[model samples]
Target: MKRPQTVRSRGQRAGLDLDQIVETAQSFEVEDLTMQSLAKAMQVDRKALNYYVKDREALLTILAHKAFADEFSPDAIRAAEDWRDASRIYASSFVERALSLGKLSEHLWFGEPLTTWSLEANESLFARFFEAGFTDEAATRLVTMLSTLCLGHARDVIQATGSMEKPRPKALRAALERLNPEKFANLLRILDHGYDTYGDEQIDFSIDVFLVGAEAVLKRDLRR
Candidate 1:
């Protein structure tokens, strides 16, 4: 049963703040969200939504930025054992949150006029690098490195999962299967299982391997 729509007067909407707008927007899927739908959901005129967001692209930019920012807690980050642990936590948070967004995660690297997802907004992450003895230059670079790794690998995981439903390369496997059906079958079976087994583990692998590589870079610099 559909409930009755609650229409508010112009005066009521005049008090509409970004927080209310953002909160209401969260109820929508990244694809189905629009000024008209958002307005309907809020039972306001579509112009009210457009007043807050000029267009769907602008709305997504704001929503994505807010979603990313809402994923972290400075206290949780501070509770890590060390910088590596902190990186792991942050990376996991980033990957998990981005994956939850499905298509919207791709906007992590994008920004527009009023976008607010900036490194300075999440200073806890940067402060972790500084506390771990990295110079300002290295710390900033590591932040970029982790962000790139998480975003790239998250995209990989998404593509791999989608490819699971796609046709497998049976022709390539057929030749291998003729020689050793057992090994080739096992090698390709992970994809048949939906390529989901290592999705979470892959995030950890990226962070751990990244930390090790970053440590080596620091040591190499010390020898300079």
Candidate 2:
């Protein structure tokens, strides 16, 4: 009786392993990179790759979480002390990483599992909020507000400058000076009331104001 030869696992097939897989996924082109291409790079059969990862979406989700964990894990921001410094560090680091990724973030935001991974990985943002002076409800709202601002501004910054740059203190201060928190709070209240209608330009303008207010509050609290 002739027995079939056993196929090696992806780890055995590729000298490079799961760590390599994660890194390869991050470094690979978000556009052209595919399951077949990843399988080739991994030196594994596509079917075998499918066994390890369900689909291209699954692979990207894994990669996104890995990349995010690598970038913003708690230890990564430990030097920032409590929530205030932590939040600023988060903003700066996120923008820096997003700038480095550029178009890849756009792909991830538009993609399935990747988008889920990105949003899920941001739970830490709320954790940081709680550590700061926010109650659970406030923390949730703050995290949502900050996430929208940060991600939207990140896209805008990349588009405007062709890359992400360090947020300028002077520039931030200048923008913050004109912010009307009462108006911004009212807008948020409107949003909470189920208003799905706002122009992108208005949202962006409001967010810029929010970011300034957030930073200002952080500074005041931390200084006290």
Query: RMSD per prediction, one decimal?
Result: 8.8, 11.3
On a 0 to 100 scale, what is the lDDT of residue 60 in model 2? Answer: 63
Give the per-residue lDDT of model 2 (tens digit) for 1-224: 99998887655654545566666666687777788898787676777665457788677667644554456544544555666556666666665566565665553343344444455335666666666665665566666666556666666555555323324433443555588656567544544464322234544466457657766765565676
Cα distance off (Å), candidate 2, residue 188? 27
**Candidate 2 Cα outliers beyond 4 Å, as residue runs:** 1-20, 73-82, 107-128, 160-208, 211-224
Question: Per-candidate TM vs. native?
Answer: 0.68, 0.53
Q: For model 2, state the Cα shift of residue 18 in Å.
A: 4.3
Q: Give the number of colliding residue pairs in candidate 1.
A: 0
Q: Report lDDT (CA) for all predictions.
A: 0.70, 0.58
- Backbone atom clashes (below 3 Å) for every candidate: 0, 0
Badly placed stretches (over 4 Å) of model 1 are 1-13, 43-51, 110-121, 162-198, 221-224
Report the C-alpha displacement of residue 42, candidate 1, in angstroms: 3.4
TM-score quality measure for candidate 1: 0.68
lDDT of 1 by residue, 1-224 (tens): 99998887553556666678879989998878888888788777777666567778777778777776675456667787888778888888777766766777666664354534544434777787777677788877888888788878767666556464323444445556678666666666754565433366767777778999879866776677
